[model samples]
Target: MTTVSEAILSRRSIRSFLDKPVPPDLISKIITQAARAPSGGNLQPWYVDIVTEDSHKRLLDLIQTKIASNPTGETKHYDFYPSDLPDKYTNRRRATGAGLYEAMGIAYDDKEARWDAMKLNWAFFGAPVGLFFSIDKFMGKNQWCHLGMLMQNISLLAIENGLATCMQEAWAVYSDTMHEFLNLPEERIFYCGMALGYEDKNAPVNKFITKRENITEFVSFID
Candidate 1:
């Protein structure tokens, strides 16, 4: 019986997962609960595509092939981050990456090792369940924000159900390929992917805890 606050505090971007399969019924229940997340005008702009077992294998193979043929990756349908990240944002990003690499004993200069570790993302970090999120191409930035709320809800609900998740914008680089493989309509644009399952608690990468700014840093109160 995890409280919402506890779930929020405990949830992490789990990069490694155990081999255990998540029951479809459980996934259904999670989604049903997460759907309660609010959207402006109740547009409910997010659409999810679930991959598991054999279908997951097929999607992984297709992604691997694409990666091998075009190691640089494809153009994303939407930008996940700012093109010119300011110093404040870039500094935080570097710190998080450095921490993760240190946890895994990957040296800062080891580019090859880093690339190898990143390749595991295509495999969903061995999670038994993978989810792809998409939205209609016509949706604007407000709808995109709505999608984020839905995703956060799913992540928190997952923690309540003894599951862990990693939201991967890296999947956006393969948007075109995924669109074709999933047979989604041309008007639907891939937003992001999520890995879901029980975390590999013993993995070194799983132990990395990223830092967050103090509440005062971003909050403002006017009398």
Candidate 2:
């Protein structure tokens, strides 16, 4: 059995997935385990919906038209990053993006290639399963944090089971489309999407793992 530490170290935002299908039963099992994640007041905030098989195809077909007409996508329902993000955060984001493109052998000046790569987010990077996460619109940041804990649990559990996942905030752009397709009520606000499946071992985009800051960078000792 894989240890918690192994799952933590091995997990990455997998951008490439194999064509293999993940059984619906396995997906349900991982979600059941993630339900154990701690939540404030046990509100659990997160509402998860998944797409696989024929449903997945239907979603892609619906979105493809929107993609062709407005490749830039709709206005994001929530901010993925602050409008005036600090240099520290900006630097880290840039570093990660650079490493990602480098792994894909995409040149920095190649605008078309970069956009092509970015578009992959809409297709969930070819992952066989896509998970949509949402929370009540009235919830505060605390509840949002709780939702994140749930997602983290899902990520870790997925790794332990030989599945990889990529948390795609890009899905926020088509919030209305997704809400309509999923037949979800307006009270629930779409937050993010996660691509889940077996990794494509030979894909270049999955070749590099992003870096993490040392504990000293953000942690402090009370002593």
Candidate 3:
């Protein structure tokens, strides 16, 4: 049996994907299992939009138009990350970004290339399925945190089945476009998106790994 430890240790954010479709049954099973994730008061407060048709093409079209108008356009609904981030969080974000760019041979000073690279998010990073997460507007940050737990659950379940995934905040950049395209009700807001499929194990970007803080830095135990 695969222990929980084995599953946790092996899960990773897979960015490069092969161009193969994930069967509906498999995708259904994955979501069904991940829904087992615990939520406070069982409000669940989450909804997912699965993209598999011309709908994805329409979404890409809308996003492209927005990006053309403002390459660093304001995210349509909520800001994905803090604008004035603290040192610890900022460093972690920069290091991984640098690592990813370096892997793709993008120069440190290349703004256009970096933004070009970011455009891949709308393409689902070449994955066959794109899943967008949404949450009710009234839910507090605690509920959003619960939604994250649910997302992680989905990613881990994918890993256990030899599939791969990348959870993306980039999708929120086009939330208004998405909301219109998906015809989602006004009460829900974009929380995030995810690309799910088999990894292109040979891709150099898949090899990038950012350092994480040690337990001593972020953990406390009073025993």
Candidate 4:
């Protein structure tokens, strides 16, 4: 049995995946365990819709059509990032992106390659299973934070089960398409989605590893 600490350390945002299918039984276990993640007041404002292969193909086709028309992804009801992020946040985002692109031998000025890579988000990065997470429109900031915890738990659980996943905020670009296909209720709004499956060992994109700041950078002691 894998320990929690082990899962935390091993988990990474795997960008490459095998075409193999993930067994339903293991998928069930990971999600069931992830549901144990704590939520504020136990509100558990989260709904994960495991996509079927047929639906996956349909969504892929929709994304392809959109990309052909507009290389940039769609806009969302809520902003994905701050209009003006502080230096600390901005630097981190840049560093992670640069590292990932560099791993793929894509120069900073390579617009074509960059756009192609961005399209992978719509393709679920080749993962066989895609998960769409939704929450009620009435949910507050606290519930939103809870949803993040749920996402992290699910990602970590996949690691423990020898599976890889990428929690994709990029999927929000297809929110309307996703909502209609998932038949989401009127009150529910799409938060984000994820791609789940076996990692493709040979993909260069998976080699990117962004650095993390030391504990002192953000941690403080009350004493």
Candidate 5:
């Protein structure tokens, strides 16, 4: 039998995708099955919005037009990382970013090329479908963690079904815009987004493999 670990190991944060389409039914199946992910008190304080068809094109067009003049995008306070983030975490982030740029043949000093690459996040990396995740603003940290499990579940299920996904926290910066665009209520907070589709095997950026810390660095055992 194919093990869950097999699916987990095969999954990658795909950056570039082919121009093919993913069937809506498959998308439905993935979302439905991901519900098996557990939550505290089963609060299920998460919400996801799928964008495709005409809506997806409209969203890209809107963002492209907005970015043409205001490249900085809508400004807001984002706490994705801690203000006093330690060097250990920051160093890892820097290394991963450097590796990604290296894989794409982009120099560390090539600011324009790097921006071009980061801008692809808003483009869903050319995936056929984009998914936005949100949580109730009233929820606490535990609920946020629960929402994350939902995201992880969806990614693994995608892998099991021959698709790839990128969980994009970059979208947190555009939560206001996305909220207005999606007509969501003020009681909820748009958290992040995801790009879903088949992987582009030939894309250099998609081939970059991020390094993971050894289990010994995080795991603790007692006698």
Candidate 6:
């Protein structure tokens, strides 16, 4: 059995998945377990819309159509990053992106290739299951933090079950289209999407692992 630390360390944002199907029952079990994640005042602000089989195909089709008609992408409902990212954040982001492109053998100047690679997010990176997370627009930042806890729980649980997951915030760019397709209530705004399934072990993109700052970089202990 995998220990908690082992599971956490092994989890990665898998970008490529195999054609293998994940049983709905297993997905249900993982999410149910993840529901144990704590929420402020037990509000449980997170809601997930699971997509699989035909529904998955339909969502992907619509996303492709929208992308083709509007290649520039849609406006995000929330700011995923600051308007002017601090040097620390920007440097890390650039480094991670560069590492991924390098792993995939994509040239730094290859805009077309980069865009094509990014489009794969809508395709769920060929995962058998996709999940859309949402929260009420009225929720505060604390609620959003709770949602993050829930997602982290799901990711860790997935790793324990021999499944891989990728949390795709890029989906927020197509929030309107997804909301319409998923028939989500107006009050519930999209937060992010997740791809879940067995990893495509042979994929070059899967080999890329981003660097993480040491604990000392972001942690402090006072005696």
Q: How many residue pairs clash in each candidate?
A: 0, 0, 0, 0, 0, 0
Report the error of model 4 at residue 47, Å. Answer: 0.5
TM-score of each: 0.98, 0.97, 0.93, 0.95, 0.96, 0.98
Tens-place lDDT digits, model 1, residues 6-79: 99999889999999999999999999889888899999899999999999989998999999999888876777
Candidate 6 Cα misplacement greater than 4 A, ranges: none
After best superposition, candidate 5 residue 137: deviation in angstroms? Answer: 0.4
Q: Candidate 3's error at 43, in angstroms?
A: 1.4
Please state the error at residue 169 of candidate 1 in Å: 0.3
State the lDDT of candidate 3 residue by residue for 38-104, as single tens digits. 8999988779889875766777777888888877656568756789999989888888889899998
Per-residue C-alpha lDDT of model 2 across residues 1-223, encoded as one tens digit per residue:
8899999999899999999999999999999999998888988888999999999999989888888998877877888888998999999999998999899999878999999998899999999999999999999999998899889999999998999999999888888888898888989899889999999989988889888999999999997
Query: lDDT per model, in order?
Result: 0.92, 0.92, 0.84, 0.87, 0.89, 0.93
C-alpha lDDT of residue 25 in model 6: 98
- Per-prediction CA RMSD (Å): 0.8, 0.9, 1.6, 1.3, 1.2, 0.9
Per TM-score, what order, best first? 1, 6, 2, 5, 4, 3
Q: What is the alpha-carbon lDDT of model 4 when measured against the actual structure?
A: 0.87
In model 1, pairs of residues that clash are: none
Name the TM-score of candidate 6.
0.98
Number of the top lDDT candidate: 6
The global Cα lDDT (0 to 1) of model 5 is 0.89
Evaluated at residue 88, the lDDT of candidate 4 is 93
| Model 5, C-alpha of 105: deviation from truth (Å) | 0.9
Candidate 6 clashes: the total is: 0
Q: Write the per-residue lDDT of candidate 5 for residues 23-135, one digit (tens) a residue.
A: 99999999999977899888888899999988999999987776787788676536778888889999998999999999999998899999999999999999989999988
